[model samples]
Target: MLSRRAALRFGAVAIGATAAAAGAAGCSSADDDRAAEPDPLLTALDAARRDADAAAAAAAVTPDRAGALAVIAAERTAHADALATEIARAAGEDPTLPSATTSAAATSAAPITPPTIDALRSMLAESQRGAAALARSLDGYRAGLTGSISAAVGAQQAVLLR
Candidate 1:
């Protein structure tokens, strides 16, 4: 019973409504999902921080290796700072603030048991492997940063740890 003009108008309205609904439903879901996933760099950051803490603690426990441990601690701390900055930059957050990807509370909640010199060396080896693997999986500045860290950790493990 509808006229040709009415049919055309109805078709247009239906198409528009369907498009609007689709847009409303999934317009930002992809972005939200990406934001919800923890950044891989978080693992690297955590490893760096833990290594730094471990090295410092081990230095306190064993004075013989204090000088080498101090260097490792300083370098690992620098690596952590760089990784945190990168994470903040990627997330479009303020670099000074703790990244939303990793809450400050979560970081503090993890207990750090001081490791022996041998354990610290093992930890560095693990960190080097992880950083190298992550570097391979990523690209651009992130890959370079992680690769550089990996090389530094490798040097620490091979040269300083001996």
Candidate 2:
């Protein structure tokens, strides 16, 4: 019994209502399911930080030998920061550290001698090897990462070898 104009208007109203309902439903589930997943870059950064902390602690007992280790620690910290930045960028979060807090604890320790240098060198060499291994592993696992991460890792290894 409806006239042609009324039928067309009814059809348009029905289509619009269906589309609005579909849009509302679509907007309700926009949260990414993968947002809760752990970030590999963050994990790598934490591991690097812990390794640097251990090295710094070992060197703390020897003031004379601490300089090289401190330098290495600084480098590791910088690398960690870089990794953190990458992770944050991927996550759409801020990358800056909360504070400039350091993990190097104070030690009333004595200076190590030439013999200690050999031990330090050996330890450093081992750490460099480990870092290189880690870099390779990361490269294999995360192909999407920027090249700078690998480059930083390579530079760290080179510095450790020196």
* Top-scoring candidate (TM-score): 1
Worst 10 residues of 1 by lDDT: 100-109
lDDT of 1 by residue, 85-133 (tens): 9999888799988765447725574546779888999999999999999
Against the true structure, whose lDDT is highest?
1
For all candidates in order, the CA lDDT equals 0.90, 0.57
Cα lDDT of model 2 by residue, 1-81, tens digit: 999999999999999999999998776565355566675455556555655665576567767657766776676667666
How far residue 32's Cα lies from its native spot in candidate 1, in Å, is 2.3
- Residue 89, model 1: Cα distance from true site in angstroms: 1.0
Error of 1 at 13 (Å): 21
TM-score, per-candidate, Cα-based: 0.76, 0.49
Error in Å for residue 120 of model 2 = 8.2
